[model samples]
Target: MKNDFEEKMADIMIGEAVTALLDEGVAIGWAVLTERLRLAIENETDENRVRAGLRAIEEVRREMHTRASERTGLPRVEDRSAHKLH
Candidate 1:
């Protein structure tokens, strides 16, 4: 169960990410959005909020890919970072 603060953070982060994705279209990739969300949450002091924000980011990205792929009848492209040696 998420606390109020964590839930609030997830809402804020997910809302912003969805807005950006919708405004910019599906060309935005996972790495770019993840980097933006990471920067947004970098200074957050609460670990729970930070974790929630990251999870929200992933949720938005996955949904974006699913929707876009469905609309375009194209396969979802995997994130480049997924193949990289991190």
Candidate 2:
């Protein structure tokens, strides 16, 4: 079904983004990572899928920061009143 295909594609995209994060570390900023992924899927003609991919990237980044903060005993940047996601 179309729903199943979309879910799988999102999962794959998230996995690739996670790999990129692990491989590149602090060097890959959120904007750069999103742009890199946008380029990777530039051939994807569906606007909806492209938007979904962007959402997935944001979600992955949020999850990463959340987990990191949990393990490090530091507040996530989002938790800081003065700082926000870059």
Query: lDDT values of the candidates?
Result: 0.74, 0.72
Local lDDT at 53 for model 1: 79
lDDT of 2 by residue, 36-68 (tens): 677656787887677668666666678778888
Q: How many backbone clashes does candidate 2 have?
A: 0
Q: Candidate 2: global Cα-lDDT? A: 0.72
**TM-score per model over all chains:** 0.50, 0.50
lDDT of 1 by residue, 1-86 (tens): 45666767777886786677778775566667776677777898987868987877776678788888889887667654566696
Winning candidate number (lDDT): 1
Our model 2 lands, by Cα RMSD against the true structure, at 7.2
Model 1, residue 9: distance off in Å is 3.0
